[model samples]
Target: MKQLLLEIDETTEAKINAAAKTAGLSAQQWLQQIIDEKTVTTWPNAIKALAGTWQDAPFSEELRAAEGQDISREDF
Candidate 1:
């Protein structure tokens, strides 16, 4: 585990503290989780950036059909 120090405005600090309390975590723990999520290099955003220029991609009809397979009464 690494320790870090950050400075933010009172409003932002209060918001983070509130969120941490709501999720039953300490302010430090919640802030660390947020930082980890933002800094993780090999996440979904990185993968999408690497796959550049999808100009010739074909839409999969099978996927389109599968999307509508699960129907519910509320869907109507």
Candidate 2:
């Protein structure tokens, strides 16, 4: 694991401390959670659950057919 140092204004620091207390987490844990939520790129669970939902729709055939096919390229 790596260590990080952050500097914030007194007001912001106070807010963070209050929030961490409210959430029942140590200040370090609360900050880490906030960082993870902002930085992580994985799809949310709700969106992941929607995968393949359109497979049986009426346009599914046309949608798949258009996947890799290309159009004619014209010269300028």
Candidate 3:
């Protein structure tokens, strides 16, 4: 694990402490969680779950099938 040194003002430090307490984690753990959440590379599960949900959605091929014709027939 790498160590990070941050210089924060008193107000920011207090806010971080309060947030960490509320989350039942140490300040370091809260910061680590935030870093992990921000650095994620893939779609979250909630978004991935929406895949293929539109029953009548058009594919890329379908969209190009008839250019200039609007996708009005597309369900969603």
Candidate 4:
């Protein structure tokens, strides 16, 4: 594990400490958990989830034709 100092404003530090206590964790542990959750949520997992869900949806020919028209207009 790496240890480093963080300089935060007093209000931000107080909020983090309070949240850590509410969750029954040390401030460092709580911060680490938040970072891990954010990393996972913002990664390719989100894109894969969207793609999987959209795969089963019915095809829309009208939507496809509209998209083609939009693409052609942007080519000019």
Candidate 5:
């Protein structure tokens, strides 16, 4: 694990401590959670769990596929 050093005013530190205490987490854990949430790039577990649960879900090609000839475009 990497370590970080931050400089904060006493008031900010106090606020962080109070919020972390209310959340039942150490300051480090609370900050880590916030960082993780902000950095997420993919679906969270709750959303990923929904995969394969829908029946007859349309695939991308099925939705975008066109069957007829293209319509003519007028002169620009």
Candidate 6:
């Protein structure tokens, strides 16, 4: 395990302690939990479940037809 040193104002320190107490965790554990929550880059399970929910939506056909068809070329 690695040790990290963090410096904070007294007010911030107090808030961290209070929040940690409220969550029934030590300051270190609370901070670790926060880090874990923030370090995730993938979609949550609920959102992952929605991946193909829109596959058959009415607009999919229109959007597919418009893909890569540029309409902005000059006539000159």
- Scored by lDDT, the top model is 3
Q: Which regions in candidate 1 have their CA more than 4 angstroms from the true location?
A: 43-76
Clashes of each: 0, 0, 0, 0, 0, 0
Candidates 3 and 5 compared: the better one by TM-score is: 3
Q: Once model 6 is optimally superposed onto the true structure by TM-score, how far is the C-alpha of residue 16 displaced, in angstroms?
A: 0.6
Which candidate number would show the highest TM-score if scored against the true structure?
A: 3
Weakest lDDT window of 10 consecutive positions for candidate 6: 54-63
TM-scores for all predictions:
0.48, 0.58, 0.65, 0.52, 0.58, 0.61
The pairs that clash in candidate 5 are: none
Q: Over the stretch 40-74, how does candidate 4's per-residue lDDT look in tens digits?
A: 74546656677656556557985586565543455
* Residues 1-76, model 5: lDDT tens digits: 9899999999999999999999999999999988999999999899999988989878977876876556899999
Candidate 6, residues 31-53, lDDT tens digits: the string is: 99999999999888999998888
User: Measured by TM-score, how close is model 6 to the native structure?
Assistant: 0.61
The reply for model 4, stretches above 4 Å from the true place, is 41-76
Error of 2 at 2 (Å): 2.4
Q: Assess the local accuracy of residue 67 in candidate 1 as a C-alpha lDDT between 0 and 100.
A: 69
Q: What Cα-based lDDT does every candidate model obtain?
A: 0.82, 0.90, 0.92, 0.82, 0.91, 0.91
Pairs in clash, predicted candidate 3: none
Please provide, for model 1 over 1-76, each residue's C-alpha lDDT reduced to its tens digit, 9 standing for 90 to 100: 7767788999998999899999899998897798898998776875788676566556788548656665557754
Query: What is the alpha-carbon RMSD of candidate 1 to the true structure?
Result: 13.6
Q: Which parts of model 2 have CA positions greater than 4 angstroms off?
A: 51-76
Instruction: After superposing candidate 5 on the true structure, give the runs of residues whose Cα lies further than 4 Å from its correct spot.
Output: 49-76
